[model samples]
Target chain A: MTSLPKHPPAKRLGLAIDLDTCVGCHACATNCKEWNTGGISAPLTDVNAYQAEQRGVWFNRVYTYEVGGEGPDARTVHFPKNCLHCEQPACVTVCPTGASYKRSEDGIVLVDHDKCIGCKLCSWACPYGNREYDEHVGVMKKCTLCVDKIYNQNLPEVDRVPACVAACPAKARHFGDFADPNSTVSKLTRDRGGYDLAPETGYLPTSKYLPPRPGKRSEAMPAAAPAPAIAGAGRFLKWVDRVLTR
Target chain B: MHPAYSVIFFTTASGAGYGLLVLAAIFAISGLMPATAWLGFVTNGLALGLIAGGLLSSTFHLGHPERAWRALTQWRSSWLSREGVLAVATFVPAGLFAIGWVFLGTTTGFFGWMGAAAAVLAVATVISTSMIYASLITIRQWNNGIVPVAYLVLGLMSGAVLLEAVTRLFGVHGSHVDVVAIVLIVVGWLVKLAYWHSADTGLVKTTLATATGLGRFGSVRLLEQPHTEENFLMQEMGFVVARKHARRLRAIAQATLFVVPLAATIASLFVAPMVAMVLALVAVVSLAVGLLTERWLFFAEAKHDCMVYYGR
Candidate 1:
């Protein structure tokens, strides 16, 4: 009973945040909120009325960080966080009821809300702090990787991608089947040397983030003193510059 | 993270059971006992048995209770596995010590001193089992090294009381044991107070902002939950607790587990032996219930990072 057909070696559905390109706009968070609000599985909780405006939603959140760098080299690291969907998700195994189960099918971790008891041990077991409680429904919720959208055939082919992937104005977010080595996401991860956030925690998330490209330097060689001749190449450049400026 | 009542009862009752057995062994080794004393043997055995029974009862929480034996396989990574192993191993010495004390009581010789050595081993074993819970880094409250210290102290106090009762029945001089019991009670109380003080500093877990870096945008908050109902992760891990109720419960625990027990032990020095014994018994029962509350609060009061999504 413990074994399943074609278990994909315990896929950890995690995200690799691009510390480089993230603008901290929270588009991912918003999109995640939108999709998860109507998701099939665990939905986040939004409590309190419009009186003050406190609410809960899950799947994604963006954070800004300041890591050590040089003078101009200093940079802001914006991280979009989600459930690592750990290879050893204590949250799933600790469930008294079999409500929490890491899928062997596509490796998407899920919850059966019907069986939940609101016990709360899985939260303590997670160092990443990804699990969220739904007070309204008295259950737990977390990221599902847009399982509905990714698998739904009714949507247009391009739009089938996760909402975060679709909504990224900067094109910073990328989603695909990371399990396939030939997949765009996998190749991208390899070329960029994408690293797991807190790899030491050993969750081994499925999503990989392409590291920020190091800033490159290309110098303009002093403008060449605008050769007195202005006639040949200089005259042509001057004409182009005048037109571009206008 | 409020612990279920079942778990709270499990740890407290079991701790006392193990703790008392440890004390019984220690007392027998000290040779302070008169020859042919059967009281220590019976008292220690009963305490040890109760601990064993409590552990067995806790297995009911497992979905596949029959597969509980497989839990021992994870000792390499899991403290629970180690705790289970040590719990069983501890009984070996406990039984040996118990039997040795009985023999020494029936006859007199270095057999009594052998009982003391067995007692020392039992003490170490009990401490090890308690540390299994206290050493978990994930559980901020239980992570402190003092958890083991606290368990040992309380165990000693409980054991001391049981010893006091049993020895008094035999009319064996019980003042020395009573004194040790009082010292342990004081020690236990101070440890619990320290634990509470440290725990009170702030949340054991982090917030969504801290967890997800969502706070960078001024004041990031959950606007809506992604799900409509409770899921397994939320049900299993999203336990919420009330601070006001916790405060009330803490007072109750301190009063019963520490205050009453401490007072009763001190008064034992002055009161008639039987009266003193009865008071200690009352104190013991109150302390058990209080500890159960304390254990429940231990989990209840702990906040989880997941509550961030819960809109706590």
Candidate 2:
């Protein structure tokens, strides 16, 4: 089962992240943890929760980088990263057990905890470092794309998107069926020039990231006229006149 | 990249085990080694013991050791799965050969064919093991042509030295074995040198800019990490070794693994049987230390592609 699906999936459900608007607030990350901890892959396992060396498994992480040089074009980019649900995910194929797999129907990669041996080879195979190891459960965990919530009939249709996408305050994360040409994610990718992370790895990630757009300088305002030269007494009188007029 | 001890031990020990099995089969089939029950028992016992022990040790690092049996189910796509399956299947022929040789005191006919089968399986298992590392394109240092070659040669070399020590201790001497050991020592070290040279000179294809798809904006640099504390990715893949220490360790590995073993093996060819036995034993010990050091370095020096995210 670790072998890839013989045929490509018809639907590629994925997210398109806008780096331009992400505030690096980590709200999506925390919301993802909050939802997923009690969702399909429960108990994210925070070790030493209150200690100085606190560490645990998390599916999404945000990183800040200074791109370009110290000039007008320079910008600070907040990059939020997670599993891209690659079409040809090496993490699935490298698994010795048939635990890691991609759904042929939707192209969503998932891990079956019961079948995992916890060898961690899948983690090594991932270039994006998206897979997280749960020390307590002794199994690999990752972004499920809120599969449980997305499919639940009890939840409102508006709440069916991924927890991260729904929780993004700035609407930086957009989730939809990328396989459809008219889908929001697909159009966003086309319009914003969204790109795959680590494309050189050849994973063909389904998710895309919209690059940060450069800031625009306003050119509509006119330059102010210089004040007329005046003698000391006249300048004082002018200042008094200006103050009184104000 | 964290250099887990269990994995290092498993690779080195099982590699040597398979190598010994191959050599033992060749010796028996070609009439190089005497067909004695005691010798057969000792040789096969040692080979199987090392193999089984190493394989068991490999599970020590697994998070769910109780679920280790599931690892054998995915051979169709996974090299690690293939390795596990091949390793276990090898035991069948190897066990039969051992029984035929030790109990029946024969190294010919059906038993000889069985030995041949075992040898082929052993070599295949080692190759599978090597492929587990080589197939990983994420690590530039491991995804190379020379990794499997170096692993095979070093395994064989270590086996040859161990065989020499055991045979000499039993008062059985073969000049051809000594020559083979010396040749393998030189050849194995040469392959290892090539591997190290490539690792040293190879440029990392993935960088922060490429990793984040931000190269078009010019050079990208990490202004702030994702978290203030180290996460699982950082702890598991962020391990870094200072260049100075790596160089020193490489020299030590060269001296102990190649220089000393090669010298001792050659000198054993000319000395008295007792002195030769001692020298062979010394060679075995030195090779063991050197192999461990080299294996440690193998993990320590490897930089995972994920490390680019951590600014490693």
Candidate 3:
């Protein structure tokens, strides 16, 4: 039965994020929240005063950071984190109510709102912090990869992917079945060298992030410029020095 | 780790309630009763009320209150499951013990032992609850193994302190309370300090190297975020701390939860009961505030595996 259920092509639909190409504008996050809010799947909630600038409702978020590296070549880094929908998801197994579970077919981690008691225990269990509490419905919220729109026949075929992936102007995000070696996402990962968020914690998230490769720099040395101090000395002293050198 | 006020209240209230239940049952077993049926009844009633209140308060943390029953499952691996089961176990025995000892004049040894066992279970459950966070390997501060031991010890200490205060209200033993309360509070201080000392270790992992799983890549850095508007990191592990503020807070917490409390206990032993009592109250308030602050710092101080992207 298990072998029969196995994906011959291994269609585990997930994203391969190219951090190198991402502009860090947060369009993905905004579009995701917007599409998800209006979509038939489910809505993310904004708690407290909606008027205040501190509104919260996003399946994905971008964080700006300055990662210190060895040597003088260190610089800032930006990370947009969400549920990786791991091969072995701790959030799913740790869930007492089975609210959080990974679909064997797509490997997408989702919470069944009806079954979820909003215990927030799953939130604690997840290391990635991808799950958020929708205070409005009192259920856990997470990235669904726009499951509602993806399967909807009413929508255009090009717009079938996640809202976040569709709206990325920088084209940093890719949605495909990485389980298939020939898939676009898988090829991109292999070509660019993809990585996981926190592999040490062992959540084994399915989503992969392609590390930004350091581009090649020219080795040709620039011509040395003359010292400005040479022109600043007293005329008599300069003349004396020149004569002595001669 | 963000020191959710709801969680703080839940752990504190529930732990104290569990401690009170355990203490009262122990008192009954040890024959330290107040020589009146009404007194034992009142003590049991108060303990029971606190416990019920604590359990009720715990539900506030849940997203779905109706699914609370499901928490009883996963006892095999989850400390939370163990805690829930133990909480219920404590409650049933306590209820039976109350009915037997308070209302029924029958010195039912069965009920007595039931209460005693319940007390033991309560302690076990509370410790298990603490371990749920403590055992996690990701969050450096919460990952410490001593968290459970500290929590249980603090529970007993707080219970003893509360007991002393209550007994005083009833015009019961005075000097002996000072002695016991002092001892418990001192133990709490030492355990807390020990916990703080032990939690300093953190699991440092190379971010780019870990991400690549190959030393071939010289270094790794996030050139872009996956999305915008403060995703999960800002929500879950977005801890902020200023060094100056942290140093000041740590000093204040050390004074409040440990030094001040310890000194007060000693003074309570030596000086007038009033001064000692005043200090003890200060210690309680200080410890509560300090521990809460410490909890916040604990979360803030602890670095997550993902934080390497942020250069933390």
Candidate closest to the true structure, highest TM-score: 2
Which window of 10 residues has the lowest lDDT sum in candidate 3 chain A?
A1-10
Candidate 3 ranges beyond 4 A from true positions? A1-11, A23-27, A46-52, A63-80, A94-96, A153-160, A168-171, A217-246, B61-78, B105-108, B167-183, B206-236, B239-244, B247-312
Task: Compute the lDDT for candidate 3.
Answer: 0.68
lDDT of 2 by residue, A90-195 (tens): 9999999999999999999999999988899999999999998999999999999999988899999999999999999999999999999999999999999999
Question: Against the true two-chain complex, what DockQ does each candidate achieve?
Answer: 0.07, 0.76, 0.19
Kindly report, for each predicted structure in the order presented, the TM-score of its chain A compared with the true chain A. 0.79, 0.88, 0.80
Better of 1 and 2 by DockQ: 2
TM-score of 2: 0.95
The order of the candidates by TM-score, greatest first, is 2, 3, 1
lDDT (C-alpha, whole model) for all candidates: 0.63, 0.90, 0.68
- Of candidate 1 chain A, the 10-residue stretch with the lowest lDDT total is A216-225
Better of 1 and 3 by TM-score: 3
Tens digits of lDDT, candidate 3, A14-123 = 89988777777888888888888877436666754344444555788876543444444454445566678777666666665656666766777777777777766667
Best by lDDT: 2
Which of the predicted structures, 1 or 2, would earn the higher lDDT when compared with the native?
A: 2
Give lDDT tens digits, candidate 2, residues B83-104.
9999999999999999989999
